[model samples]
Each structure stands twice: as C-alpha cells, then as structure tokens.
Target: MKTRFGKLVCVCAALCLLLSAMFAAGCGNDAHQKKIALVFSHEPQRWTDGAQMMKESLESDGMAVDLLIFHTDEEQAAMLTQAVDEKPDCIVLAGGDIKNFRDSLEKAKEQHIPIVDYDGLTQDTDAVSYYVTFDNYGVGEAMGKYIVQKMNLRTGGGPYSIEFFSGSDTDSNAKLMYQGAYDVLNPYLESGQLRVPSGQSDYAASAIKNWDGKNAEARMKELVANHYQSQPLDIVVAASDGIAYGVIDGLAGYGGTWPLITGQDADKKALGCIQSGKMAFSIQKDPAVLNQKCIRMIKAVVDGSQPEINDVTTYNNGVITVPTYLCLPRIIDKDNLSAVSK
Candidate 1:
C-alpha cells in the first residue's frame, strides 16, 4: 500500500510539471505575437529591392507584421483608415503620405499607437513619431563627385553632357538628389568644362520619371528621336539604377554605345551593367542596416524612450525634416560590385 501511494505521488508530480511547461510555452507564444502594422505608399509587389529587404528583416524579428500596401495617396488614405480602425500597436509608413491620413493618424495617436516613417519623410504631423532615411542630397553629391572625378571632366576638351533623369517630383529625395547633382555639375557647366545644353531648352526634353524605369526609358527614346544634337549622350544621370537600366534599353542600337551613365541603388542588374562597363557607378545602400536602425527606433519608442534626431528643420515646401538619420551611401563600380552584394 505504501508503494502504491508512492507511485500515485510520482504521477501527480509529473502531471503538475507537464501543466507548468504548457503554461510557460503559452506565455512565450503570447510574447512573440506582438502585432506591427506596416503601411506603404507604394504597392509591395512593386517595392524596390531595399523596401523588400526591410519587410523580410522585420519579419525575422519574431513579431507579426501586417503590411497594408497602397499605390496612391487616395489608396493610402483609405488603408490608413482601415489600419487605424484595426488599432495596431505600432504603425510604419513609407513616406510623407502621412498628410493623406492626418486625421486618421490623430485618431491613432489618441489611442497611443507609435508611428515610424521611412523612404520619404513627412512634416510636423503629430502622428509621425520617428523618421528613417539616407542622406538624399549627399547621395546625389556622391554620385556626381564620382562621375566628375572618374570621367576627368574638369580637364575635358571633348564635350560631355549628362541627361538628368529625376524621380517623382512629389518625393523630397528626388528634388534633393537632382539639386545636389546640379550643384556639383553647375560650376563645371559655367566653366565650359561640362555642358548641359538641354537646360537652355527649358528642360522640357528631359523628363521626370516618377521613379518608374519604363517611364525613364520612354523619355530617353523621345530625346533620342528628337536628335537634340549630332553628338551622342556622354552621361545619363539616372535617379535610380532601375531607371538607369531602362535608359540603357532606350539608348540601344543608336549606331554606337553612349558614354558613362550614373545610377543609384546598386541593384543586381546595375552591378551586372557595371561589370560590363555599361554603367559608370552605382550608390550602394544596405537595406538590412536601414531595417536594423528602424527596428531600434521602434523598440526605443516601445520602451518609452524618444529617438535622437541629428537636426530638425522645416523646409520651405512645408515638409518638416525631423532628426536626420542618414545612413552611409557607398560608391559601387565593377571593382567594388562583389563587396556590396548580399
């Protein structure tokens, strides 16, 4: 009878241990289920390689990420309405489309939802709690400096004209990049070392591509058809490598391959183009690093800490530049392609 009692006690102890284990597992799963809502102004299907990397990196953090993709400001507003309704713990927006749903975001703010912005920046919206981005003007300056130095344009006897292809006008990054390049090349243009004849034509022949590669290509074809000059284009200052690829396609079969083309993004195809000497340089940005910085910012907010901004200023465009968190932008050419890859 004593042995039977001993066995019964052992069984009871084992049952208690099993129950405790189950409870611990449940607690862990619950802890891992924190929901984060990621709202994008652009469709996820058409997101750039950098944006796609960010999504993957966020998913690896053992939290649930609910991505609501939108293609237009109107679509973004509608999605923001829905996301606010869902009452997510955190909201991540791609850009300044914050204005589209300022009211809805205020509602989120009332509910204590933390907001993070990436890609493009937004202004003094109470809804935008944090901002993440690279140095837009600096990126362009880097590209411009590389081109000027590489091509030996300052000592040029032969004329070289770079066709500037900008991104979406609505995006602040596009404007800064274009202006930065202009600042770098303008001096040379005035000195008769670098030529931009298209400037005299009201820049009508040149086009703003809205960051679309196909659009850039179409515009390049139009320039080629116009036969703007007897000389071949010496440089194509593409806003992104994706657009650079399109420009290359448009300039195809023009009797001879054109001169140096500059692009940003350091995309795989862009790297390939560099290897083939079709592209002069690409700016390398690691989305993984950017994602890690964003995660840190979000976690800081969640931990009841405020993010540090380098400097905050309001641009004339009414867009507020909150603390600048600019990442390192590297210059990539054929020699450095392998170093910048995944």
Candidate 2:
C-alpha cells in the first residue's frame, strides 16, 4: 500500500510540472506573437532598402512583420486597408500622406494601432505615432554652403548666375530642403552676390514634378539655351541626385564651361559623376542607419516606452507637432568620398 501511494504521489507531481511548463510556454507565445506591418511606397530604391532593413530588424526581435509594397496612391490606400484588417499592433509607413490612406488609417485609429512615419510624413492626424528623418533643411543648407564656397558666392564681388531646381513640392522633405537652401542662398541673391539670369530661381517655379530627372533635364536645357548661351553658368543647385543628373546632362549638351553642381542622395551614378568631376558633392543619408533608428523606435513602442525622439517642435504634420528623431546628414565630396568607396 505504501508503494502504491508513493507511485500515485509521483504521478501527481509529474502532472503538475507538465501543466506548469505548458503555462509558461503559453505566456511566451503571447509575448512573441506581437505583430507589425511594414508599408512602403516602393518606388525609390532608397525607400525599399530602408524598409527591408526595418523588416529584418523587427523579425530578429521575435515579432512577425508583414511587409507591404505599393506603387500607386490607390495601391497604397488599399494596402493600408488590408493591413489594418489584419489588426497589426503597429504600422510603419515609408512615404505617402494620410490623405491617400485616410479611410484605412481611420480604421487604424479605430483599431488603436499607431503608425510610424519613416523618412517622410503623412498628413497630420491622431494616427501618426512617430516621425523619423534626416534634417532636411540642414541637407539643403549643406548643399548651399558647399555651393557658396565652391562658387565664391559670398565674396565673388559680382553677380554670378545660379539655377535652382527643387524636388516635387508635394514632398514634405522637398519643401523643408528648399526652405533651408533658400534661407542661405536668398541672402546672397538679395545682396546681389549671385544672380539667376534665367529668372527661373523661384522654388515654386523650379519645382521638379514627380522628382523626375527627365523633367529637370528639360528645364536645365531651357535655362542653358535662354540664359547661358554666351556666358558660363557659375552654379546649379539640384535637390536630389536624379535632378542633378538631368542638370549635368543639360550642361554637357550645352558644351559650355562646367559649373560646380551640388546634389543630395549619394546615388551610385551621382557618386561616379562626383568622381569624374561632373558633380561636386552628394549627401550621405545611409539607409541602413536610418533603418536601425526606425527599428529602435519600434522596439521602444513595443516595450511600452517612448521612442528616442530628439526633436518635438520642428516637424508639424498639419494636425499637431509630431515627436521626431532627426538624423544628421553627412556630405560626400571628392576629398572624403574614398572612405565611402572603401
């Protein structure tokens, strides 16, 4: 009888231990089941590369990531809708406005899911969770500073012609970048240190539709034909590398003295151009670095902590000021570009 009791006791203890192990696993499953959705505009290679980095990072943290890529505005809206229907814990938007995704993002509001904007902003609304991007104004300011020094705009002692081309006005970064460039160069323009003989210097007037290089090239050609036919153009400030390519192409066709040109986005072709002395500089906004910052923000959100927001007053999404983490951008010129190549 004692042997029988001992065996029963052992069986009971075994059952209890088994139940405890199962319960612990259940809790762990709940912890690991947290889900996030990554949405990308997918048009620009930069955006796609950044999104991929974010996805890999999130998955490494043991959370499931649903990466959605959309090409058109309508596709973006539909993808957001579908993502919300999945009831994800959070959504990361690479680029686009809340207006295009209003219906779906409203569902996000209803579902209590937060949306993080990466490298760009959507329309201001309660749905916006956090914002991360480079100091866009500073980016253009860097370009402006480089241009001023290269062209001797500050002390050139006379009117030097400069042609300006901005990214699409629809882009928030483009607007801020143009504003930064204007803040620096406008003073020179007003002080008569520089001139735009083509009179195509207005940011609004010089905006590149869709950020297309062809459009920019066409404008560059027009400017060269109408204004620089007989004289050397001192400088041309392009907001992005694609636009810079167009501007350079126009310069090449004009067959005149090459001007000191500046651009953002260290694109391979642009970097080649810089190496060949066709372009002066390109801003290095490393996609992998920006991706890591976004991932850190996501982990913070998931851990129920505030993300590492560095700026609170600068970026307003039209509804309210968004808490932002701005990354400083670096310049890639002939002097230090070898480091990048290595």
Against the true structure, whose TM-score is highest? 2
Q: What does candidate 2 score on TM?
A: 0.89
The per-prediction CA RMSD against the true structure, in angstroms, equals 5.6, 3.1
Candidate 1 ranges with C-alpha deviation above 4 Å: 1-34, 41-63, 71-75, 95-103, 109-112, 123-126, 156-158, 200-207, 314-319
lDDT of 2 by residue, 1-342 (tens): 999999999999999999999999999898768799999987568889888877887888788999999988888888888899998888888777666888887779888888889888776576788998999989988988887777677676557778889998678788889888888888889988888888877778989987889999999988888888798797888889989988887776576778888888897887899999998998989887788888888888877888998899988877878899999899999998888853
The local lDDT score (0 to 100) that residue 19 gets in candidate 1 is: 99
Off by over 4 Å in 2: 1-32
lDDT of 2 at 146: 82
- Tens-digit lDDT string for candidate 1 (58-146): 67866666777777778889888888888776887775345578898789889989877775765546556767777778888987787
Q: What is the lDDT of residue 227 in candidate 2?
A: 80
- Candidate 2 lDDT score relative to the true structure: 0.85
